[model samples]
Structures are given as C-alpha cells and as structure tokens.
Target chain A: MIQLDHITWNVSGRTILEGVTVAIPANTYAVLMGSTGCGKTTLLEILCGLRQPTSGRVSLDGVDVTDLEPRERGIGYVPQDLALFPGLRVREQIGFAPKLRGMAPEELNQRVNRLSEQFGIAHLLDRLPDMLSGGEKQRVALARALAARPKLLLLDEPLSALDESMRAEAVSLLQRVQQEHSLTVLHVTHSSSEAAALGTLHLRMVAGRLEVESKG
Target chain B: MRLNRSNLCWLVLALITVSYLVFWALLLVATATYSTPDSWLQVLRSPEIRHATFLSLVTCSLAAGFALLLAVPVGYLMTRLEFRGKSWLDAALDIPIILPPLVVGLCLLIFFQTKVGKVIELAIPFTYQVSGVVLAQFVVAAAFAIRTMRGTFQHLSARPEDVALTLGCTRFQALWHVALPAARRGMVAAFCIAWARSLGEFGPILVFAGATRMKTEVLPTTVWLELSVGNLEAAVAVSLFMVLLAVLVLVAVRATGEKV
Candidate 1:
C-alpha cells in the first residue's frame, strides 16, 4: 500500500504540486493521467523519493518512508527516459541493483538469467543499451527495475516512447508481468486507452491537485 | 540566385577556416625548419636538455594527476549540487585560468612569505624547489581540468544515477558505478588538456621555482634559460620538442573518442 498525505511541492515560490493526497492499495494497477506540465511526473518523483515534497508524508506498506532515501523506500522506478546505464551490458544492467546490494554472485546470476529469460531478452544479455531497439530498451529497463524486487513499481510514461505496434506489445507484456508478479504499480500516462487497458484504478491531476477519477 | 548566395557563403566560411589552419601549419613548419637536424641531435644529446625533458615529463604528469584528483570532486559538485553563491563560486574556480601567469606566480611567491605558507614550507619546501614546479603547474592545470570535467558532467544526464538510487544503491555507489564510467571519456580529455597546459606553462614556474639547473628546469624554463644564455639553437630545439609533446597530447585526446 502507498499513501501520500497532503503533498505540496514548490519550486522558487511557484507551486508545482498543491495539497494532493491519494492512496494506492497493494497489487493495484493505479494509472495516473494528466496533461503535459500538470505535475504528473513530479508526483511520481515525490513518491519514488527522487524529489522531496515541500510538505507531505509518504507511507509505503504502512511504514512512514517520508524521510527515507529512494534506496530505502523499497520502490522500483522507471523514469520517462528509461535512464539505462549506458556503460553496462543488458545482463549487467539488470543485475545492477542486486549487485549494489551485495547479492551473492551465483544468486545474482540466477536472478539476472531468470529476468532476462522472462523478458525474452536472454539473447541480448551481452549487448549494450545503445544496440537495443526501442522496445528492447524498454524491456531491459523494466527488467532492471524489477531485479531488486521492490513491492511498488512506479513507471513514468513508459509507453510514450514506443511506436504504435510496440506500444500494444508493451501493454500486453506489462499486463502479463504485473499479474504474474502481483505487483503494485503506479503508471503515469496521458493516454486514456492505456489507463483502461492496464489500470485497476484511475486518478487524474488538475494543476497539481490529484482527483480519484474511477475505481474498479 | 539563392543557390549562388549559399555557395558564396560556404566559400567565404571555408576560406576563413583554411586561413586559420594555414597560419598554424606555417608556424609549426617554420619552427621545425628553424634548426638543422644536427642541432636537434646536439640539443637532445645535452645532459641539461635531457634533465629538463625528464623534469618536464615528471612534473606535468604529477600536476595533471593532482588536477584530476581535485577536478573530479569539484566538477561533480559544481554540476550536481546547487547551493548559495553557486554562480560566484563557479566564477571563482575560473580565477586561475583568467589570471596572468606572472601574477599567479607572484601571488604564490608572496603567499609563501606569509605565516601560514611559512609553516607549510617548513614541513615541505616549495619556494625555489622542484615541488614548486608542480604546485605552479597544478594551480593552472587544475583550473583547466575542472572546466573540462564540469563540461563533461554537464553533458551527462543525472537520470542514470537517479535510477541507481532507486535500485538500492547509495549516492556514492551510484557515482562510482554510473557517473564515473559515463564520464570516462571526459576524464581522459581533461587529463590531456591539463597535461598539455602544464607542458606549455612557463611564467609561474620561472617565477616560483626559479629555473634552477637540473633541479626545477622544466621544458618551458629550459627554453627561457637557453635563450637567456644566447643558445638560440637549443631554445628552438626545445620549443620544437614541446610542440611535438603538445601534438602527442592532442592525439591521445582524439584516441579517447572525445571531440578535440
């Protein structure tokens, strides 16, 4: 479960996110929809601990994580750009988090191999991100995010970069993976169709204020 | 008519570029041709020239290494963090680059006369010492390195490091694993820039280190000392050698796959 209590973020005396509050239940596919420059990404960033709100409390799984660092929050985040480490190969990229956490080499290898196989990127494990197609890079990013096994997955405009064909394929892959892992996801997007396809709950942002649009 | 105008514009631009290229080519060719091969051999065979060459290489390497060590952190801070007076601080970092080399050397000379510098000098001699050569070189070299590194970090996005943070890595880990590797080419470019700058540094070394024979005689100082003694052949030979070293540094920078 994720709970944000009256979050407000201001930059240079300009409010980017107003007093916004919402809750996402565990295993819920919550899609946040907002127009461009509506602070959708800022809200996601606050939840992921990338940016601290001017005033708010962020709780994850009933634990107060407001003061915790991103690493300590136990959340997986995929930024809009994917932000894959360019220097690391696909296998190394996926294994990055676990490797940083001092996971045993054998266990880390097993986990990386499993994720690569699951993502259907086993063959591209040795290749760098630059060599991968847009869809392949997306898969690698998703696999890298999930490698640490965070309870909450926060994806910011994950499908916006892909072409029409790739978007459909990515949507199906995302749905299947979310169900298989039983993961709680907060997916930020502008596409209503994407929300209908993936979200168990829908939320919208209007000038930084969040409103619950629908619930299933 | 539009096509003719475009062609004329391109022709003018090309001529201007070629003129600058020709000027540099002429300077290098003239310097290379100034002295005979026999004079170059004699200069290279001289014990004093050999000592100066060895000192120049050693001091510049040490200075560049120190510059890099200082640059990485200072550059990262300048790029990644925002604090009060950041603009002022950024400008202050450029002081060494902007200051006259003679003034910098004079400042160093005066600074050593102070109580703090006197205390430091008691522990490690720098005034008119071999270490002074490195200190003078580093003061200017580090400024160039820092500028190069700052440009490097500016070009690199912070998103990868942010992702690393979410992936259970601490800030240091993220920097070590992601930022450093991404900045590898930039770091190489910075080192080469610092090395070349240090190679050409003359004024500060002459003032602070005093161009002592076989002790503080770097290549630039060697040229000055040779010219002071009316050894024009030796000076030109040393100058040509320094140019060669500069060319080699440029080649190394290019080999790193970074823009020269």
Candidate 2:
C-alpha cells in the first residue's frame, strides 16, 4: 500500500496542497483529476520524491520512503512529455534499468524482448524516440517505465499529447498493460472522460485537498 | 526568382554569406601565393619554427583538454540549477567571452602580481613562462567551451535524466549514460572550438606569457616574432601554417560525422 499522510506543500508562502491525505492499495488504479492549477502535478511530484512535502510522510509498502531519493523510492514516473532519451534506441531505453543495475546480458535481453513483445514495440527496437509517432512513443515510454517494474507507476497526463484517434488507443493500451502486469498506478489527468474510463478509484483535487469519489 | 521581399531577403543573406567566405578565401590565396616554396622550407626547417609549432600543439591541446574538464561541470551547473544569485552567476560565466582578449591577458598579468597569485606563482610561476602559454590559452578557450556545453545541455531535454533517475539510476548515472551521450555532438563541437580558439589566441598570450624565443612561442607569437625581425616571408609562412592547421582540425572534426 502507498500511504500519503497529511501532505502539505507550500511554495513561496502559497499553499499548493494543504493537509492532503490518501491511501492506495496494491494493484489499484487511482485516477487523480483536477484543474490546471489545482496542484495535481505537484502532488505527483511529491509522491515520486521529485518534490518533498512540507509536512507529511510517504509510505511505500509499509516502508517510510519520504526521505528516500527518487531512485530508492522504487517509483516509475512518466511525465506529460514522455521524456524519452533521444540518443537511445527503444531497445536500450527499455533495458536501461537492468543495464544500470548490471544485469547479465542474456537476462537483460530476455527482459527487454519480453516487454517489447508485450507492449507490441518489438518492431521499434532499433528506432529512436524522434522516429516514432505519438502513439508509438507512448507505448515505448510505457515499456521503458514498466521494464523497471516498480511497485507504483506515476503518470502525469500521459495521453494529453495524443491526437483524438490515438488517445483512445493509448487509454486501452494503458488499461491492458496495467491489468496484465497487475501494476498499481496513479494517473493524473484533467480529462473527466479519461478518469471515468481508466480509474478503478476516482479522486479529485479541489483547492488543496484530495476527495475520494465513487469508483468508475 | 523575382525580386519579392522574401526573395530579396534571401538574395541579400546569400550575398553576405558569400562575401564573408570570399574574405577568408582571398586571405588564404594571398598567404599561399606570397609564401614561396624556399621560404616555406626554410621556415619549416628552422629551429624556432619547429619549437614554436611543437609548443603551440602541446599548449593548445592541454588547454582544450583542461577546458573540457572544467566546462562539463560548470556548464551542467549553469543549466540544471536554480539558486540565489543565479542571474549573476550566468553573467559571470560570460565575462571571459565578453572581455577583450587583451584585457583578459592584462587581468592575468595583474592577478599574478597579487598576494594570492604570488603565493600560487611561488609554487609554479605562470607569467612569462611555458606554463603561462597553456594558462593563457585555457582562460580564453574555457569560456567558449562552457558556452557550447551549456547550449548542448539545454538542447537536450531534462526529462530523460529525470526518467533515468526514476529507472533506478542515480544522478551521476543519469548524467553519464543519458545526458552525456545525448550531448556528445555538442561536446565534440565545443572541444574543436576551444582548440581552434586556443590555436589562434594571441593577445592574452602576448600579455601574460611573453613571446620568449624557445619557451612560450606559439603559432600566433611565431607570426609576431617573424614579423618583428622583418622576416615578411617567414611571417606569411607561419600564417599559412596556422591556416593549414586550422583547416585540418576543421576537416578532421567534420569527418567525425557530427556537425560543428
């Protein structure tokens, strides 16, 4: 379980998030929705250890990870831009985690191949991020994130950049991937339709608080 | 094409570009024509020429290498950081580039006269010494390297580094694996520019490291030395030599398959 206790973030004397508390059980998909300035991204950053909460604790799987670095916290994050490394090919990008951790070559190859085939990005292994289209890049980003196999996946408006046709496909792909891996996800988006379609647990950020709504 | 505003603008820009290239081509032709084979052979075989050429290579290479060492961290900090006095810090990084090269040399000369500089010079003196040549070249070259590196880091998105961090790589790993590889082209360009800048550096070297005959004489100072003795052909030959070296560097860099 991921537990956020009394998370309050104040920036330059302005309260972006105040006393925000929430709990997400393992393998649950929580869709966090709010307006542009409602601090949804800030909350995601706090969860991912990119930003520390002013007064709160972040617990991951019963361990207090509030003080842990982003790497140590075991959280996978995909920002709105997808932030793919242009220099690395899709295969290298997907296998970055195992490569960094010094996994054996055969095993690393196996892991990358498995994720690539699973995500249907095997054909794009040799392609760079710029060569891929919007939907392809989305799938590659997801594959790269899932290659590490974190306990929690944090996505900030992952589908916002997609065209109308691609957005629906991306949503389905995300749903299928999350379900197949039994991954716990916290996806922040401004689209109610997206929240309704993918959220197992619906939550909204109003002013500076998190309110749990009915499950979609 | 007709002389529409857009076509006219294109024509003007093309003419300006051609005019700049023409100036350099004209100078190269004149230097090559003026420098005869006998004079070139004499200058090439001369002990002073050999010494100056060797010293120029050694010092400029050292300067460019050291400039890169300082540029990477300073460039990264300037781009990827937010701190108090950041604006001032940004401006400070540009001081070397903005100051006249002569002023830079004068400053170094003055600095070595101070207590701090005197203490430093006591260990290994810089002014009017062999080390001063490399130091002078580095002071000017490093600024260009830092500027190029900053642009390199900025051209690359920070998201990849952030993603690398999330993927269990530490900050340093992110820089090494993701950021560095992405900025390789830029780094190469920066090094070449710094190398070229150091090769042609004159004012600072003249002021700080005096043009000692067999000690601190580099290519630029070689030109000055030959001219000072009224050896016009020798000076032209040295100038041609520098031009050839720069061309070789540029060609080698371009052959690396990365645009400068």
Candidate 3:
C-alpha cells in the first residue's frame, strides 16, 4: 500500500509534482495517464525512492516511507529504457536482485527459474540483452525487477520501446504477470488505452497538479 | 566536397600513428631476450638480476594493491559525494600525474630528507629502499587508476544498484554484488594499466629509491643504472624486461574489456 499525501517535487527549481496526493491499495492496479512532460515518470521514481519529493509524506503499508531510500521502499521499478544490464545474461540479470540480497544460490536459482518459466523467458536465459527481441527484452526486464517479489511495482512505460506487434503482445503479458504477482502497480504512460487496459484507478497530471479521473 | 577531403585527411593523420608504433615494436624486439645465447642465460641465471627482478615485482605488486585500495573508495566518494573542497581533492589526486616524473621524484627526495620523511619512514619502511619505490609507484598508479575508474563509474547508470537495493540488498551489498560486478572489466583494465605504468616507472624510483643494485633496482631503474654506468648491453637487457611486462599488461587489458 502506498499513500502519497501533499507531495511536491522540484527539479532545478522547476516544479514537477505540486501538492499531489494519491493512494494505491495493495494488490490494486493504478495507472497514471499524462501528456509529455507531465511528471508521470518522476512521480513513479519518487514513490520507489529513486527521487526524493521536495516536500511530501509517502507512507507504505501505514509506515512513513518519505525519507526512505529507493531500495528500501520494497519497489520493483522498470524505467522507460528497461535499463537491463548489457553485460549480464538474461538469467544472470533476473537473478541479480536476489544475489544482492544474499539469497542462497540454490534458492535464487529456483526462484529465477520459476519466474523465467512463468514469463516464458526460460529458453532465453543464457542470451544477452541485445540478442532478445523487443517483447522478450521487456519480459526479461519485468522478470528481473519482479525477482525479489517487491510489494509495489513501478513501470515507466510498458510498451513504449516496443514495435506495434510486440507492444500488443507485451501488454497482455504485463497484465497477466501483474495479476499473478498480486502487485500494487503504478503504470505511467502517455497512452489512455494502455492505462485503461490495466488500471482499476486512473490519475491524470496536467500543469503539475494530479487529478483523479472519473470512474468508468 | 571540402568536408570529404577533411575526413580523408583525418584518417590519414590517424594512420600516421602506425609509423611510431612500428618503430617502438622493432626497438623492443631487437633488445628482448638478446641475440646471444649466453647473455640471455645470464639474465636468467644471475642471482643479482633474478633478485632485483623479484624485488621489483614484489614492490610493484604491493604498490598496485595499495593504489587499488585507495582508488576505489576515493573514486566512489568523488563520484557520489558533493562535499566542500571536492574539486581541490580531485586536483590533489592529479598532482603526481601532471607533475614531471623527475619533479615528483625530486619532491619525494626533499620530503624524505625533511621532517615528513622521518614520519613516513617510521610508519613504513621507505626512503632509498624497495619500500620507497612502492610508495612512489602508489602515488603515480593511484592517480591514474582513480581518474579512469571515476570516469567509468560516472558513465554507468546507478539504476541497477538501485534495483538491487529495492530487493532488500543493503547499500554496500548493492555496490559489491551489482555495481562492482558490472564494473569488472573497467576495474581490471585500471589495475593492469596501473601495474604496467608502475613496472616501467623510472624517474621517481631513481630519486627516492636510489637504484641500490639488487635492493632497489626495478626493471626501469636497472636500465637507467646500467646506462648511466656505461653498460649498454645490460641496459638493453633490462629495457627488454620492462617491454615484456608492458606487453603482458597490454594483452591483459585488451582481453578484459568486451566493449559492451
């Protein structure tokens, strides 16, 4: 559960998010729809602890998480770039978080294989990031981010980097995976259709103010 | 039309570097292992030569190890922190790099002769000894390693480490398991280049370590000592040793970084 109240963040003194408040219930999907430069990604980053809000209170599961570090927020964030480590193999990449958390090798391998199989990425385990197709890369990135089973998952743009064919396929895959994990999601993107496809709650930010859209 | 000509001219100028590279290669080959069978055997068999080479390796390894220890933390702090006097600290690291080798050596000599010398000597065995060579090498190698590594870390995104942290890894764990592993190629490259440079370091070693025959005579210092004493053959022999060490480092460096 993420409860963001009166959040304000400024980059280089230019306000990105101004007094925005939102609550995301655990296991519920939240999608944020906005135009370019709408601070959608910034809000996602702030919630994950990647960027600090200039002024605000962020509570996670009723605990104050405002000053917490991004890693400490129990978030699995997939940035716009998909940000896969180029040097790491698909299996190595997916297993990185658990390795960092010092999970036993056998345990990590089991969890990684289970996630890989679920995402249909088991065959591409030894492949490099470049070798994977667009849809495949997206799945690998998601699997890597979700490896640790974080409470919240932040996706900057689910299909932004994919071609039209891959994008359609990946969107459905993302929906399945999110539901399977029972994750609280903050999906940020420019497409209303993409948001409507996964969102239980919708948010729109224009001119630095966050507005809750009317329920469909 | 003019841009095409300029591009051709730039390629020509870049190709011109091959001439000097070939010349250096020829120079190294002519002296390496020597033409005569006895002299080659002498280099391997002579206890003085063997001991000096051993001492050089030991000292250079120690210096390179120390440089790595100091460079990683210093590089990380400089790259991550925004503290007062940060720029000054960067400039300080570059002091040995920009300063002429002879000037750095001279400064070290003066330092050892003064009150600071006594303090350093008391702390670690140094001044006109093998330890002195290690200290001199550390100053030069650490500067180069830190500069290279800091740039490497800056080019890398902090996102992967952040991702690791979110999965319950601590800050230090994220750095060790994720960030540092990602930087494996660069770190290895830095270490090899620094080791190569230290192995071939001459001026600072001469001034601070005093080329004390078997005690302080590293390969480069041995070459200088032999040449200054008018033994050209011995000088060429030691020169050959230094060149081999350099080529090994070059090959090691090329092997590590995969251009990902």
- The candidate maximizing TM-score is 1
Task: Please report, as a residue range, the 10-residue window in candidate 3 chain A with the lowest summed lDDT.
Answer: A207-216
Q: What tens-digit string does per-residue lDDT give for candidate 2 at B83-147?
A: 89999988998899889999999999999999999999999999999899999999989998998
Residues B1-260 of candidate 3: C-alpha lDDT, one tens digit per residue: 56698899987887788878889778767776455646766664677678778987888788877887777777777886677898998898898889999888888888887887788778886788778899888889888888867876887787777666666677787667766877777788778767877887889888888877778887777667667888777777666667667778888888886221
- What shift in Å separates residue B49 of candidate 2 from its native position after superposition? 1.8
Which tens-of-lDDT digit does each residue in A14-126 have in candidate 1?
99899999989999999999889989989888988889999989999999998999999989999889999978999999999888888999999999999999999999999
Interface RMSD of each: 0.7, 0.9, 2.2
lDDT of 2 at A101: 85
lDDT digits (tens) for residues A1-216 of candidate 3: 889899999977799899999877888788888889978888887888767789999999999988888767788988887878757899998998788778899999999999999999899999998798878888988999899788888998868888877776778887898788889888888877787777888889988888988543
| lDDT (Cα, tens digit) per residue for candidate 2, span A1-216 | 789999999988999999999999899999998888999988988988888899999999899999999999888899999999877899999999988888999999999999999888899999988899888888888888988888899999999989888888888988998889888999999888898889999999999999999764
Lowest lDDT sum, 10 consecutive residues, model 1 chain B, at B251-260
Give Cα distance to truth, residue B57, candidate 1, Å: 0.6
Ranking by TM-score: 1, 2, 3
Candidate 2, residue A106: Cα displacement in angstroms equals 3.0
True-structure Cα RMSD, model 2: 3.1
Candidate 2 displacement at residue A37 in angstroms: 4.6
DockQ for each model? 0.88, 0.76, 0.56
Q: Candidate 2 regions off by >4 Å? A: A10-15, A163-166, A207-209, B1-38, B109-125, B247-260
Candidate 3 or 2, higher lDDT: 2
Whichever of 2 and 3 has more DockQ, that candidate is: 2
**TM-score for each model:** 0.97, 0.88, 0.87
Local lDDT at A91 for model 3: 90
